[model samples]
Target: MRPQYPFRVRHADVWRIALPACIAFITEPLAGLVDMTVIGRLGDASLLGGVVLGALVFNIILSLAYFLRIGTAGLTAQAIGARDPADGLLHAVRALLVGGLIGIGMIVLAVPLLMLSGWLLAPGDGVREALADYFYIRVWGAPFSLINFALLGWFYGRAEATTGMILQFIIHGINIAGSIVLVQGLGLGVEGAALGTVLGQIGASIIGLMLMLGHYGGLGQIVDRVRLGELFQRVALKRMFGLSRDLMIRSIALQATYAYFAAQGSRMGDIELAANAILLNLLFIIGFFMDGIAQAAEQLSGKALGANWQPAFEEAYRLSMIWGLIIAIVMGFGWYFFGPYIISLMTTRAPVQAYAVQFLGLAALCSLTFMPAFVFDGILVGTTQNVVMRNGMIASLVVFVGVAWLAQPLYGNTGLWLALHAWFIARGIIYWWALRRIRSRMFAQ
Candidate 1:
């Protein structure tokens, strides 16, 4: 076997992991497209508006729960690097337990959560009713979705991108197919769409469990006679929860920026709201592509740090940056040339199409501005640098608010896009500076 110490990281090394991760990430936006397409075809802008708003509410909630994925991935990656299968298994177990508890909490708090979101979003009357229906149905799947986060993070930490890719495919495939059946054939409307997603999560969780068991040589092998009490050790629990708390804060700050973006668009008008939703999906597509490279950073950097090899870590970071930038540029050009056609497929509304096209160029531009932040996020998260991540996101949110406050009144939607870009640019700068200052210190013996 080749030695990894001097880590001769190459583009191929990044792409090997990134390609499958990219496909998995792309499935997310594709599922969004399916939701919009099914609802948009119903030919009511209000219905479309409801799905958009309902999605944002979940996005915020899920962002809070996202600690399961990011924290588990970082911790498990380091465990894998150190060749500690037991530690990796334990990390996954802890994450799943915490995720399940959090999911149940969300269900218990569903009513108040919905009411709070409705008041904050302030959509039109027609949209409000539809959003309520979607929320009630979707909340039931919270546990499944949360547990899936843990499963996915564990796979990525193992650098098992293909497994992660397969898991995502199963979830999204079920979502798109079930949604079509329920919404189109059964005429369930937005409720059907919501139920489809819930069903997908439930199905995926079951399959994920079976896969994990089979891979680990069944239940007996998994537990391996370890005392149940060991899983709840105070030091381990504290470390896990501490990491979760920081990642949760970072996720909330990130989600707040997106929620604000959707909220402002809602206030504009239904057509504008619908248009912005389409563009937001496009932005997600771009973001996820870069996230593929970020996954590489997470696995490689975490692995390097786990092995206590600075050279490998540096090479991983360098390779990730190069590939991230390349993918961003490619995506920008792809959107610029083909965005109109894609927008046309999403909706039949002439005004929505025109408005979305008007801002398509700016959305494409985001691919580049957002690249640095994405790459840095993977590296930091993989290295378990949670403090920097939490602080950077909060600071970037402030920059976003300031930019949007000044830009929105002056340029309308254009200004809103600008503010979003400013947020990403700020994140890139802050993460870059922090990493530079701490790099040598982090690798110190």
Candidate 2:
């Protein structure tokens, strides 16, 4: 007779993880909100436009390297599931090293990247100058930012959501305080905003490193267990590289879609671009909240897969989806009712507020679709199924482009948003189909 095992997922466990993660994830966009709010108070649409464009450029660039966070979380969770502390340590170390290297590369290539981005964006002179100032100062934070990504990923993968939350709080708290001081108190303008961001990143990286060392019982112990040679073992390195490469491709496609959205908005004029930025901030809030649930799914599902516990994986998937949908519905209602207030808080510009309010309803409708798309992302990443994720993102990107082509000519900015809505829906549908196939194959064993 076969042995029996208990595999149950409780709502309490999900909430325990999701709540802290929600707090942590939300801090990210809050930082952006703070930046926008401070700059918007400057009462210059060009300044807001410049900051928005510059931030979007960095967002796209950094998102390409997001595999450091995502791949580390998935790998570390699996290692923990297999009860291998050494493997978990090695994954974190490897991710940090790679992230550090990539961050440096970004710094080295910053000049050409800025030039290219400027050429493509082709903003008015006022906006371009502001973008240049912001980008130049902000690029210095790349190494620290990437390092924090690895640290946060490792913590989240270990189900140490509280630590992740604390780290994010530290980063954002310092950022918000510094931005207010530099931009408002000191009159440093866009450059001040960028410098404040750099300071926060540098502080977070240092503190996060100290915390990591302490978590592993100091540097001596970590050094002893994380053998340099072991980190480069042929099989493990192959798997790591494979996962990172695939995820990078997937991230680039995803970022490209957003970059396209921002670019299209820019073409509509500064007021429109600024308005889109404010509305998108609301979307970011929604995404981060739903991502809290996805984070739970990643950890739980990865651990389940590592242990070869199919039932546990199923339960994790089901409960995560349930909670995610619930939160999504609640957020949809909140945004519908409170979106104008939220937009007002981000910017005092009358035109920007009016334009953002026009599309707030569409943005709310899109929130309902984020849960399935994002939760499935967590599930697939946890299982290390990067190939399917990559394919689905690419396929969805194609659909978005096609739909935007047709819709934009007919409906303007509303058409662009409609394309975005379709993209989210398509991603969810594609991932769901992929999930079914993966379930059949994995469970059939």
> Which candidate leads the pack in lDDT?
1
Give TM per candidate.
Answer: 0.90, 0.89
- Kindly list the per-residue Cα lDDT of model 2 for residues 1-445, writing each as its tens digit: 2222345678987887899999888888778879988999999988999999988898888888898898999988877776774648998999899889988898899889999999988999999889989998999999999999999889988889998999899888999999999999999989989998999989989998998898888999988887768878999999989998999999989878988898899999999899887778678878988989999999998877766678888899999999988999999999989998988987899999999999989889888876799999999988889999999999999999999999998999999999999999999999999888777565454
Clashing pairs in 2: none
Clashing pairs in 1: none
Model 2 TM-score on a 0 to 1 scale: 0.89
What does the lDDT come to for candidate 1?
0.89
Model 2, position 102, has a per-residue lDDT of: 85
Which lDDT values do the candidates have, in the order given? 0.89, 0.88
List runs of model 1 lying over 4 Å from the truth. 1-8, 39-51, 122-129, 187-189, 263-277, 344-359, 407-414
172-238 per-residue lDDT for model 1 (tens digits): 9999999999999999999999999999999889998888888788889988835578788899898
- Give the range of the ten consecutive residues with the poorest summed lDDT in model 2: 1-10
